[model samples]
Target: MTNRRSFLKGLGALPASTMLASETGFAQGIERDHFSDIGVKPFINAAAAYSALGGRNMWPKVVEAMEYARERNVIMEELQDAVGKRLASLIGCEAAMVTGGATSSMTLGTAACITGTNEELIRQVPDLRGMKNEVIIQKSHRYSYDHGVRSAGVQLIEVETAEELERAIGDKTAMLFFFFLNDAKGQIKLREFAALGKKHGIPTLIDGSNSVPPLSRLSEYLDAGFDLAAFSGGKGLRGPYSSGMLLGRKDLIEAARLNNSPHADTVGRAMKVSKEELLGMLAAVEFSLSFDYSVENVRETRIVHLIADKLSVYKNITTKVSYPRTESGRPHLQIFWDKSLTPLTVEQAQKELEDGEPSIRTCYLALSDGELEVGAAMLKDDEVDMLVQRLGQVLAPRAG
Candidate 1:
């Protein structure tokens, strides 16, 4: 649950120097040891934008926008409408709205498909008596997050082939669901899957959370004919962790809004996105669209090489820099070593980094031949040198 409390706790744990350098517009000279006061430890994120890790920190402008929004008082519905319109225009989609996260977007979007703006049906959700109650998804695309869709009280019909999908669709079928990352694993590709939805007149939704940095992906699925797409505001976009964006189809988006907060007894009433979060999300999208990704990519690549080069001194250690073709379009370092030659296991090394001063968190890939994955996307510029030094110390030979 990456809520405001958790986000504030993480912010409280940041070092004063980091806070000062970030220019987040907080009152000057008012520093409180919020994490230390509560015994919560914070670490440098060398991992991806995982919810469990509190996602990534917001960009400076995003934080500023949030602060700006904190002082305003306006009609919630009007704010949603205005922000939704602005986001849709920026993303080149027909419509868009900020939600609690990608999961909330899933739930709201599913509810929209299950029961449109019909007032009676809107209040009677999760109790589908005669409405479209089935959502078709590839078996390979089935994941933990699909719980969001299931929360709408619709049965998920899983299919492996295009024919099975067509057979599965009927009067009860509401929407076609696709997980963008699992495109290769599934029997049907992205375009074909969306095309099938079009052929049958069913709406399609793609979960593309954490699929930015290329930036074009914000509109890619919509352009591919998917009626809707969900994206995380926290991941890659560097907005508030508790916020997300749902984009596409004006009517469905309208229904989603009606089913969301500021409306009583709705399924999304509890999934609240505050004014601060809304403004922050908008700022994140604007900043990300205007950001020069080429510079960031080059810097990330350099950081990966620095870590790999510094750690490659040990004879038994092997370092490989890999650029994954998946959602995370950044360079990563995979460090592999023979455990027999060293006293430290991959788990032990990761734990040491985590427990050390200026704590660090890196991916410990037990399945990748016991290698460690170091990501540069979340590392601050100054933290890079500290990370290199920490790796050198941890990987050095121990005294017998």
Candidate 2:
């Protein structure tokens, strides 16, 4: 889970009035909205799972669970135990801990892997002056999010080859970290990486944050023998945006929790996973696990086909429907346009969609490869029509 720091307006500290603004303050009221009075109306999400597009929507059950947890007040420690145990069971892990978000989990998980449940070490995080604080990561696995590991006070050692990775692991090597999104770039595969970590007696952690939605991936890392893994509760899971889960060996997860909520002075003190978000995450996990993938695929395919057919007449454009897998478990549609026909670049098309009657978000990937790819996983029943209509508007003939 990513640590969501509330925006402090002018003074470093938020005024009490600002914090008490509205239930929807987290979702809207920025100065950029041209749709309606910024605070009074909701903005349409056309950008798909971008954090700026409000990440992902919470499942209705998650919202209800949050409300249920909010209405009652209990000792937070007990709440943590129950929520953690249930979450661990649902994810098929020995234990689990909810943090501010996936990045918080990454930071706390890294700290716990290095420092264990030691109180002295827990308080000295992001500054391991006299501890084993080196983490081995593939050079290809480097990303902006790796800052989470650094935030834990660990130094990242970049390795590209299997031999380099092996040599990089030493007594000071606290963790072997892998970013699931960069699996294609890394030389170490999951099973091989896990084996290497086991051989060296080092902890292995895989950041599977945006890699969810396919469901089986919930257990895939564990099954692959990873010692610890972090996932975004908000992304594919459709839980609260502020919640995320750290799943791993019982000891490590417990240590992670020790450094998290219901406790202060630890590195993760400020990264609290509220009781409401915890409950909502549990409900979201249950709902996601219970969903039928095959049936969902059929529906997703029908939607993809409908969009593909609707735009088939435009000879200048080309559309091929394919099942693309994201961090989320299920496969969704990837719609790409032929860039050769007209000068309507991907960016222009995206902006056009965004500026339309109902703003729509589409995927944008910049690769040396030919055209741009847009995934359809984030679209809803009504948004599907909106997408088709908007595409037609942009691709139609120009007036003389």
Candidate 3:
């Protein structure tokens, strides 16, 4: 295992500017004591919390928000309620609530759908000894995160198509759940799914943790009639990585709150959000909405173009721009390579890049025809130059 402490030293000396920075600066000011004393070393955060990539770096604004909240204390419940109300207004939902993260929101939301605001039943979740424990989920929508819902103690009945989903709903079906990313795999769309739940008077829920890039995705499900929806705070939103939001119908959201934090003796109590995290996440939401995605794209395009311009000297390489789907506009980048001309494989190139001086973290995507895709999102100002230099050296004619 990599001794992360040693890695910090390898980044050379911490910059003087960092000396003045605060301890709660990691991932938007969550006050990471572990890293605060150690701080960030020099590694490209390409993996972006993919779990495989070790997640992403925190946004500075998020850190500031966390720090601001830490200074004073307020009633945690009141703070969450106020934040939820503000978030509801912002997202055009009937109500909203923050949770530990996207998964927490899912578990809590499912639990609420299972018990509503009933005190006795809420505490008896997952026991299901004598309750409506079934949750209707499409066969195609079963993803890793479904465990969160199932963790609430509901039995998940998998189905496909409108007919199957409708049939699955009954006295035991407490909620109909949808994983947004799997929309492509499912035959039913949000409107159809929501309608099925509505027809039966059952609540409909959606897990949209990674769906924010399109930007409008935030409002898409709400407008489509999902009774409850959850999204991540860390990734594109730049909030605390450990935080997320659950938003939807007022009564449902309220029920979710009663089942969750700032209180006790329920499933969501263990996954509480600190006042700092709550405020910081809200600030991140505001900042994310206010960001000029188009300008950010233009900036990305320039960096990618620069890298491509330098790499163009090599033969058998072609560079093309790639864009991420997002409401803020999307990330712009350049993809370089032509298999016939280069003797190296994409994996070999990736290894070479990761092994080079100053080290470079490039995003890789495999094509149907076997090509490597790279981007400019996580590169620092100096790292960009290092990237071009290393790629040039690695691709240059090698001696026998």
- lDDT for model 3, on a 0 to 1 scale? 0.72
Candidate 2 residue 213 Cα shift, in angstroms, is 3.0
- Per-residue lDDT, model 2, residue 133, is 85
| lDDT score of residue 246 within candidate 1 | 94
Best by lDDT: 1
- Ranked by lDDT from best down, the candidates are 1, 2, 3
**What would the per-residue lDDT of candidate 1 be over residues 79-137, giving only the tens digit for each residue?**
99999988876777789999999999999999998888988898999899888999999
lDDT tens digits, residues 1-400, model 3? 1122321222233332452253234435355566447864455533234434544345567677788888988999889889987776666567888888889999999999888899898888768888889998889988778999998998899888788877777788889999886677789977889888888899989998877654456677877878888988776676787888998888888888888866687888899899988998888776565554454455566777887787787775567755543213244444455545556776788788777665566654431124444555555556676666777666655544
TM-score of model 2 vs. true structure: 0.84
**In candidate 1, residue 208 scores what lDDT?**
91
Please identify which of the two predictions, 1 or 3, would achieve the higher lDDT against the true structure. Answer: 1
| Candidate 2 residue-wise lDDT, 186-274, digit = tens | 78887888888989889999999987756667677877888888988887788999888888789998888888767778888889777
Model 1 C-alpha lDDT versus the unseen true structure: 0.84
Q: What is the full ranking by TM-score, best candidate first?
A: 1, 2, 3
lDDT of each model, Cα atoms only?
Answer: 0.84, 0.73, 0.72
